[model samples]
Target: MRIYISADMEGVTGLVDRDDVQPGGRDYERGRRMMALDVNAAVRGAVAAGASDVLVNDAHGPMRNLLPEDLHPAARLIRGRPKQMGMLEGLVAAHDAMICVGYHARAGALGVLSHSFMGHEIEDMWLDGRPVGETGLAQATAAAIGVPVVALTGDDVACAEATDWDPSITAVAVKYATDRFAAELRPEDDARQAIEDAVSAALAAPLAVPEPAAGPAVLEVRWQSASVPATLAGLPGVTATDSRTVRAEGELPALYRQFGVWMRVATALTNQPPYC
Candidate 1:
């Protein structure tokens, strides 16, 4: 079976602050190594579970957090940004399953370093009228592509979020949140082992891929700045929901791509540190 892994940094083992995940921060180097190790654990599990191929997507900010040299040799990496699908880049229907590693909870959640696609620019997001964070959106997009998200690794809050979105997914929590930037972390070895074991068991008997959605999908975003919505409104099929919000309608994957464009536009217009 072919497997895809999307790796984000915030919920990575032992990372509880932006300093750890963002470039130029004192601990960013250590954080990236930690991120790669978590992904490697998943890669090892996938290979042991009979995966013939594995693709890893560096799905955090700047999209260059994972170095090719640091990843498991069995896994090929999708690194860099401007990817149409953002965090879900390199994901396709042909992949048997997708595993999300080191993902945090949605914006405003108490999970460590929790935020949506953007640090604070995106206030909230809704897909098909259901509130969703990275977890839900990724799962929805994979489902639309006829791929199942078999497992996820993150903080306790992120794990709970994933389970709430789809109980079939196996979620392994490496930390328990005390605040957005504070967590009670598990030992690195213990956390990695949990990730590896959970991924192996989940992929051993993967869930059936859902049928691709036949109807149009709606994506709505509430931005922190009104200028973002005003600017995004100029895009075709995008409607201004209010002063600080915009809504778009299209099919899945396409809708997902449009959201990426909207984020880039917002990033260009705003100048604020993430998690501010």
Candidate 2:
């Protein structure tokens, strides 16, 4: 079976903030290695479970966080960013199941380094009005391609959030959130073991790919500012709140993807870094 693994760095074990996730910081390299280790654990589990092909998409900043040499020799890696599918790159109709490793909740979520596609662009995203994080968006893409999200690993909040979106998947909570910025970490060995165990469970009992609510999907976003919503509303069918938000109702995956472009554009225009 073909399995797709989407990897992000924020929810990685032992990571706490921006420096660890960015390109030129002291903690970045070490944090990336930790992410690679977690991904390797997933690959090991996928191999053991008899998956014929495993694809790892490095979806973190610059989209090149995981080191290629450190990845499992057996798995193919998808790195770099700004692709047609975004974090869901390397996924296709042939993929039997999907796994989100090191995913955190969206910005404003009570999870470590929580942010959506971009720090402030996606204030929040709701599919059919149900709140979803980046993980949920990745799941939506998988669903669109008829693939189910079979496993996920992160701190407690992330796994908890997944239950609402993908209740049937395996969840491994290797850390516990102390707050949005900090967590109660597991010993390295335990965290690595837990990741592999969850992957094994996921492969043994894959969830049925549910219909990803063919929208009339309404994505209501509350950005950190108001100006961009004004710019985003210029897109057809996109609506702007009086001041601080943008809402796009009556949209489907295709249109939502376009709508997401507006969100990113606005975020880039408004980005001030250091959270303001």
Candidate 3:
């Protein structure tokens, strides 16, 4: 079996603030190590469960957070940005199963460092009338390529969201969220062990590819700033559904392509000088 893993920072054990994941944050180094450790654990778990090939995607900001020197030797890492599929870029039809490692909760959810795509730039997002966070959105992208998300690891809220999306998928919550920036964390060793064990168990069962949404998917993006929606509304096939909400309609792949572009734009706008 070939396993694909998408690893993010915010959901890693002992991480809770932006400073943890962002480059400027005081704890950024620690956070990156934790993220890499989680990925390594997943890689080990996948290998233990008979996965012959493991591909890990660095899905956090800068898209290069994982330290290659410290990563597991059995897994190849896909790092850096401008990826065609963003978070799910490394996933493809050739992979037998996927594992979403160290993911956080959706925007407004009670989880450590919880936020959707571009953090504060995006307030909410919906696909085909169902509200989804990073896990759900990434899963859809993987599903498009006939990959089933077999396991996920994160905080309590993220695990709950995963279970709600597909109960059969294995979920491991390394922390229990007390609020957005705080949680009762599991010890690093324990979290890693649990992640490895859970993944091994999940891969031992028969996995099924998830079905894609019906044709002409509609994506509703609610931005944190009215300017974002207004800017997107100017694009063809995109309209402002509300002051801070923009709507885009197209085929799944096309919509996902555009959505990646939008995320980049929003992220750029997020750090501009107030005068700009």
Candidate 4:
């Protein structure tokens, strides 16, 4: 069996503040190592579960966070990007199941460091009129490519959100969110063990592909600033619903591509300082 794992940092064990996820922040190294550990745990689990192939996607910012020397020898890692699927990159027909490691809850969720893609500018995201977070979007992307999201590891809120998307999905919460930036963390070793066990069990089960949404998917992004949405209004099939909301209607794959474009545009606009 082949398993795909998407790893993000904010929901990794013991990470609570923005500094932990930022590249230059004092805790960034710790966060990166913890994320690598978490991914390795999942890799071990998949191996133990009889998976013949495992692919780990560094899905966080810049898409190049995992330490190559420290990663599990059995698993291959996908790093860097501009890929068609952002977090869900490298997903293909051969992957039997998918797991999201260290995933947080949606933007504005109670989970620690909660935010969807482009946390700095996007207020929230909705699919087919229902609000969904990164995990949901990731699940949809997996489904579009015919892979089931069999398991996920994150904080309490993220696990709950996963279950809401697919109740049968196995979930391991490494921490319990006290709020957006604080959590009562489970010990690092304990969290790793739990992830390993949960992943093993999830992979052992029958593939339960999430039911795809009926009809064309409509994705709406609510921006932190009205100007951001306005700027995206001219894109084909993208409509500025209001001052702060942009809606894109199309097949799931197409919509996802558009979302990636918006994220890159907005991130570029906000992450730079004026030249003069």
**In order, what lDDT does every prediction score?**
0.92, 0.79, 0.85, 0.86
Clashing pairs in 3: none
TM-score of 3: 0.95
Q: What C-alpha lDDT, on a 0 to 100 scale, does residue 190 get in candidate 3? A: 98
The parts of candidate 1 lying over 4 Å away from their true place are: none
Candidate 4 lDDT, 8-60, residue by residue in tens: 98889889888788787799888899999999999999999999999999999
Cα displacement (Å) at residue 110, model 4: 1.5
Off by over 4 Å in 2: 249-252, 274-276
lDDT string, candidate 3, 220-270, tens digits = 989878777777777898889889998888876667889988877776666
Candidate 1 residue lDDT tens string, 1-276: 999999999989999988999999999999999999999999999998999999999999999989899989999999997798899988988999999999999998889999998999899999889899999999988999989999999999999999998898899999999998899999999999999998999989836977766799889999999999998899999999799989988988888888888888998999768999
Error of 1 at 275 (Å): 0.8
Query: What is the Cα-based lDDT of residue 152 in candidate 4?
Result: 92
lDDT of model 1, residue 92: 86
In model 2, what lDDT does residue 178 have? 88
Q: What shift in Å separates residue 126 of candidate 1 from its native position after superposition?
A: 0.7
Candidate number of the best TM-score: 1
* Per-model TM values vs. the true structure: 0.98, 0.92, 0.95, 0.95
What TM-score does structure 2 among the candidates reach?
0.92
Candidate 3: what lDDT? Answer: 0.85
| Per-residue lDDT value at 80 in model 1 | 94
**Model 2: clashing residue pairs?**
107-115
Model 2 alpha-carbon miss at residue 226, Å:
1.1
